[model samples]
Target: MAILVAFGTIDGAGLARSEDTSVDALQLHGPLARLLRPLVRLFIRTGMTFPALSQLLRELYINVAEYDFALPDKAQTDSRVSLLTGIHRKEVSRLRGAGAPVNVVPAALSRTSRIIAYWLAAPDYTDTTGAPLPLPRAGEAPSFEALVSTLTKDVRARAVLDEWLDRKLVSLDEEGRIRLEEKAFVPQNGSEQQLYYFGRNLHDHIAAAVENVLGQAPAFFERAVHYDDLSGPLAAKLETRSRDLAMNVLQEANREAHSACETDAGGDWRWIFGIYVYREQMKPADKDIGKDAS
Candidate 1:
């Protein structure tokens, strides 16, 4: 991505905003390059070459340049846009003539996401304290089957249950009750789910990070804690504790947000709050590698 950005921009120097800082330059930009390595490998496996990505990126870069760069008196010229985006003047004209991006999410995936949303928000599916209630598999109006029907009549309740069970988001008890095991319903496998996640999760996360760097006044929640070294046993304990603490906070916040949405009568604002836990082991250092080879 960095290399593509460099090649596409003026003299191989990519576009930078005036507000960019030294910390932002190193911390954000450097990690982004490393992050794309695995994604690039996936693209290769899927037959999406660098050229294809570059073509799509060209259009994206043009869109950003058109919006982010201020227009002087009169219309934004192809020459000026070319200078800003680092694309050639003729190519800028051609790209500018092209249509805007189309957003067409699959109906099934969208309905599935809505089901998860309603499951979290609706009072029928939750207890007095706003915790999700373990529901009977079938029978009455408030049962799990009824909940599935409210979202979509096309899909059966058992099908939805099977998908959730496959993802480990929900579990079925021996007595035929359905219990929510995860705060959010995420598909563990399938291309449709992966694409949905790529759109939803990555877009929101990147947007929040950008807002924190660029926006002023009330900030969005963005924070993390990291340590380089820890014993394996200690790290395992910390992971468990972190998951517990994060889930409790998130579930409480979810209840409050749902209540606010229900009561607020005259606004069109929407927001998402997400919690994620990640841990990975560091590669052995060169010094340590030599000792082990002896």
Candidate 2:
């Protein structure tokens, strides 16, 4: 006998089978609405209409059904995809020929990120305390030139320096040594690089949540601390403390990963460790609504 669970079924052998369970649409509605609210807000602010988003979602539905839900050793048919996604068979057939969305990291963004990672982690570029050291603009080992050259010799170190200077990612100290800014990892506002990360990070976070919700084993780390009521001063203090702790964790992880990768045989596997903090003022009406629901 198989014991049915909210998400799936556990067989007599004690193995869970997620495919045996049907998804409850009502169970998903509240969560889906919460997830889509901010995204829909972004679309409206960016002038993306409902029709445009609908078309994009239609294509994605077909793509996911065809690729992700396909049976082993079986050709995916339009009818099957249509049934899985609740999209019309004709629409599924039309989109089946369309290319899947490509996930390409911008060249400049990739290069810059790697360079910063190395600077933060490599012993030569960091101090005894593991902080990135200010480097001479040009010279021998430990200089900015050496750091850039270690990553790539195709682009001249001076050219890279100039670009970083223009973007204010790095600044020259009184001694003319180049110092990386604290916010160097952040891309320019409204830039292509920023948008790329916005999509990629959100997608990864949501994917982890979905995997856990689907009762997948070996769940990814997903946890948050929340407080509804706090004085302004208390909230500010907590926010500052949170930022410091988060940065310490990120920097330590970066150092460890950097050392591991030095001798790591490169493979198709990729990993991301991300942290985010958000604070919003609660309106009186919103508080009342919450009280009523509770």
Candidate 1 scores a C-alpha RMSD against the true structure in Å of: 8.2
Which ranges of candidate 2 are over 4 A from the true structure? 1-22, 97-102, 285-294
Q: Give the alpha carbon lDDT tens digit for every residue of 139-248 in model 2.
A: 89899999999998778999999999998999999999999997697788888878889989988877876776676676666666556566788778889999989988
Worst 10 residues of 1 by lDDT: 1-10
In order, the Cα lDDT scores of the candidates are 0.68, 0.80
Per-residue lDDT for 1-294 in model 1, tens only? 012122111111232322432344555564576557668898999899889899888887777787667566667778878898899988887887453443567886777777766776677888886667888988876788998988798889999888778867788788878888763454555467667776677677667665645642355555555444566887788789999898778767776776776778856766777766766675677235324323
Global lDDT of model 1: 0.68
